[model samples]
Target: MKTYHAIQELEATGIVTAGITRRHGGVSRVPYASMNLAKHVGDDPNAVATNREIFFKQSRLTALHYCQQIHSTRVIDVDHTASATLKQHPEADALISAQTGVALGIFTADCVPIFILDVATPAIGIAHAGWRGTFAQIAVNTLTQMQTRFGTLPTNCEVHLGPSIQKCCYTVSPELLNQFTERFGSTIRKGTNLSLQTANTIQLTEMGLPVASISVSPFCTACRTDLFYSHRAEAGQTGRMLSYIQLTTKN
Candidate 1:
């Protein structure tokens, strides 16, 4: 929504609508600047509401579903029956749905946003992958959940890696690096930075997802702050962008 930058492939999908927002086009100010989507990040609630409304209107989506990302392997199922009333948003890093109208949304600053659409089954999933979430294999875990919940096959799923902090701007701890190397081997290391996008792509490919269905966004949030909000790039004082997917019936 808000005419934000988006992944062209995902945008071209006829059955599902997917997009990622940028740092432009909203009421947030100063450090958060504009188009800030997260409520807990200290932006005024009314401003966030206005931004969200603009996005919702522009995207033509139904009520959005989101979660409290704990950088873990937990994945939540969102269905047509899912309700927005919650004591708190589910604490999970990924969300999956077979339902149409409803959109699955994941917020990120510099962290990775992985979106999967099972085109054959008309279902979708979205994940928030910070280093901890990646280390927990959130992408693979989400696919596994989709398989169980929607009978989604990896071959029929299209994966999109949205703008994030790539190896050029990301550095991990030695312990973290060891864990990554053990799982994906040392080829993931590009100097001190860990290639999170590549690592997740590898994990998905190893789990039987088609190589051709995966598309990685070339924009790095930290490198393209003019079009995105980057937490690490902004010294952790920045706002967040929303990466989302929706399964909508043909009009």
Candidate 2:
């Protein structure tokens, strides 16, 4: 397995640099196996740092930004001045950046990872969307932050939906599924497996972004244990993948 999962569509866009991490190519114990990018998942700090260094060197990003990620809609801005060595990242689900050479990273096991880049500006963003964050409209709120701060327009934004547990292996309880269906219209279900990407796409399109502006990944983390990590599939004991995006600070 490769060290990263990238958005091929945005790679050609020149200013946007983005990718996600996989389970292979790192130094860690079983369950984490190798190449786990998150520290909160019981992986050794030194091992996690080594794995991140591999990704940082490969990506050529100047700085990296991450959040505590409490399944909330909180958004923050990261630029050149951000303290790269800070141990405690802000508690936020989404991070937007207008600085060059800075990367925004979101860690996930099975939840959706969404990357958004402004086609016309040097602005980029990454969001971690679990069912709670999605239902709370984190994606929408992230867009709103970009629009307000960077003057970004959704019409000119390219969105990438990274690997997550799809409807095939993601199932919720009857009461939870009923609640989601009532709020977001009937979910496209396979015995209660929720289509998170679909729900997010609906909200994005409703916010004036063209349905075609989004590029979705076909890989399901739950189904692809050989490559990625799945919290649900592994019963909450697993490593995490890093979903990242950046604006090349190169002048």
Candidate 3:
């Protein structure tokens, strides 16, 4: 079985590697069911470690820096010299880095795995955007951090919203729907179903990123349990897919 779904648009930039791991080809069982990359979940530690080993070996990525996600809008800036220490994962939902050979990753099941590549500055960012993070505008905050730290321009960025729970299955409460509607406008909600992808896209576009530069995945995690682990569809018991992007030492 395949180990991941590569983001071809980002990889085509020829200076980065981007992809999201799939739920197959590992040692996780039942709820996680193989290839689970997150440790915070209830999966066995050995299994999660083995799954990550399998993914790293297959992806040929040497280092991974991910945060302890809190569903907040916090963004972390990873310096080029960060690999020297064994620091605990920062409590954040987004990560931006300009370092080569280091991959930035985020875990998600139903939430969106947002990939940001500032092709001009050659920086990369990965954000985990659930309803809370989406409402908090985590994606835009990531770009803003890149702008401040790396002089990254919105027009030079190419973003990818990886596979996640879409509106077709992302039904929410009326109060929550009203909150999203008020912030992101009425178009972001379809009945009680909120479109987190649309909300993130709308925010990114408002940040001056070209509409054509953003690419959203068609795979809805909740709708495709065969290919992904969906927290909503699986009743909150599931694995997480790792969406990652790395800057390479090339043009």
Candidate 4:
């Protein structure tokens, strides 16, 4: 599979591959615009299915496994067969797998989509973290699952925080901001701006992963409407971009 231009940092790793798709490469129009991979967002299902096919073909992934994503910290284990039945999988905010040829997918617009791959073991994980999920420590849960299921150490894992709404463009209500501060302490800042990226990083660091192994995308979906979808910028009327990663086998 040719590397996606948007996820150049992830491609540079050589060992694992990932992509944060843009809004240009699919067939959806207006509202959905293009490249809408989510089915529940009111986009045409046929368009979404075709878009998914294009994405899989472009990424060279065998199958795409997606979670229902309920803004919680639940994580599931996926294998080849599991990937095929992703439509029926329970609502989870994260997924982990040690099996090859299994692609784990997460959808996000303003929410964060994080991908983790263990260099020392054959495990991969994906997490969907909105403010709710971030405060719930979804990233930490994903790392813990990798450790427990595959015996992968946190230090051996490298994580990529895919494109999402950054703090600069992510504004929240005072009440919501206070909730974050109350739960996460100083991580939410005194102002009403809650940095979900920083919060997730701190959570992962607390789980024993080094800061150097974590790579965060600087592109904010709300700020870069030309390239990504933004739920807040569009007043919850936009489509979702998908961040996907998988362990592919050598044929």
Candidate 5:
């Protein structure tokens, strides 16, 4: 496997291996560039399949379970059987699984990919948090599902907020600003700039997760255009990046 150890610090937790991918190491051209993992975003299907194969091969993950994400807060628990049935599963924004070797993958092109792992349990989760899903509290919902389904407590879980469009470049309309203020009041932002990272961290804290257990990547997708694809920076014509996490079985 052509593994990248850029996130080795996160791996020290002994429960999860998480990292954000750069726009390299796959088969696609120009607009889709390279390393694009999503098939529904107008990229060539063959190239997407090839990209997925390469991604799993490099990460050493066997199979990836995907969600038909609809920017909602709904989260589902995936087992070996549920992993095989993802093609027909409901459109949800998050996935949690204690099933080993079943990689939970979520697609994004600027939106956040939040990965969670419980050190006390064999559980892992991945979430797609766009502005809509973030505002709807998908991260909280994912953590709640983990506690409800796997008996994992928030304090025992470690979180990694992967690369996404950061507040440095994620400007929003007045309508979105007003809606955020109306819903979360002062907790969502410091000013006109809506800090999605802060909002997610706050949600995790409210769930009893320690402040030190959460880590946010400093890279901004929109700002670091050379490394990541950004939908806002590319005017809605960008390829999606895949953030995935899975547990390896003891065999």
Candidate 6:
């Protein structure tokens, strides 16, 4: 079974390794089923460990730096000195790094996993964008940080919005929909369903990123439970998939 879905556009750059894991090819039992890489979801520790090891081997990644993921717009910069294990990670929703050989990861079941690759600066960022994070503009904050820390320009970046519960399956409250429409304009919502993808894309484009520079995955976790784990579809009793990106040490 395939272990991951590569972010084709990012990998095409030949400077980074990027993708999200599929819910197959691992030892995780029912609910998690298989290929679950997160340890905070009540899955067996050994199972999670084995699954992560499987990803590292398959992806040829050795070092991993991930956030604790608090559903906020907090973005952290991961430098060469930063090292993190599953048990020891910072409390944030996004991570950016210019350092090679270290994978920046985010755990998500139904939230959007935003991947940013600033080719000019050779930096990478990954963010966990749930509704709250999207509302607060986490994706924009990541780009802003990249600009400040690494001299990254939005035009030099290629971005991908990984699979999550898209608008078709992500119905929100009327109040939330109004808030999104007010912030991102009315085009981002259909009735009470908000498109987190559009909300993020609008902000990114407004910040000078061309619309063509961003690619969004068509897959919806809630719609395709066979391929992904969905918190809403699974009633909060499912494992999380890991979305990660790493800069290759090779020049």
Q: TM-score of predicted model 4?
A: 0.92
Backbone clashes, each candidate: 1, 2, 0, 0, 0, 0
* Pairs with backbone N, CA or C atoms under 3 Å apart (clashes), candidate 6: none
Candidate 6 residue-wise lDDT at 171? 93
Candidate 1 vs candidate 5: the lDDT winner is 1
lDDT by residue (tens digit), candidate 5, 92-199? 889888887677888888899998988788688889998898888999999998888999899988888888988778778878977877866666665567778877
Count clashing residue pairs in model 6: 0
Assess every candidate by TM-score.
0.94, 0.94, 0.97, 0.92, 0.91, 0.97
lDDT of 1 by residue, 92-199 (tens): 988888987777888899889999999888789999998888877899999999999889999998899999999888887888888898889987888778989988
Q: Write the per-residue lDDT of candidate 4 for residues 12-118, one digit (tens) a residue.
A: 65656678788877889899988888998999999998888887788777777788889999998875355562453688989888877777888899899988989
Task: Choose 1 or 3, whichever is better by TM-score.
Answer: 3
Off by over 4 Å in 1: 82-88
Q: Please, what are the lDDT tens digits per residue for candidate 2 over residues 1-251?
A: 36997789888788877888889988888889888989999989999989888877776665677889899999887754554742336799999888876678889988999998888865888899999988898899999999999899999999988999999888888887777777778754557678888888878888888888999999999999989999998989889998888777566
The lDDT values for all models are 0.85, 0.84, 0.91, 0.82, 0.80, 0.91
Worst 10 residues of 5 by lDDT: 1-10
Cand. 3 Cα-lDDT: 0.91
lDDT of 3 by residue, 1-251 (tens): 67999999899989999999889898999989988989989999999988887888889888888889999999988865566321336799998889898888899999999999999888999999999999999999999999999999999999999999999999999999999999999989987899999999999999999999999999999999989889999999999999989898774
Q: Give the TM-score of candidate 6.
A: 0.97
The reply for model 5, stretches above 4 Å from the true place, is 1-6, 80-88, 185-187
Better of 1 and 6 by lDDT: 6
- Tens digits of per-residue lDDT, candidate 6, 27-127, equal 99998889989888999999999998888888888888887888988888876565544433679999999998888999999899999999998899999
Can you list the residue pairs that collide in candidate 5? Answer: none
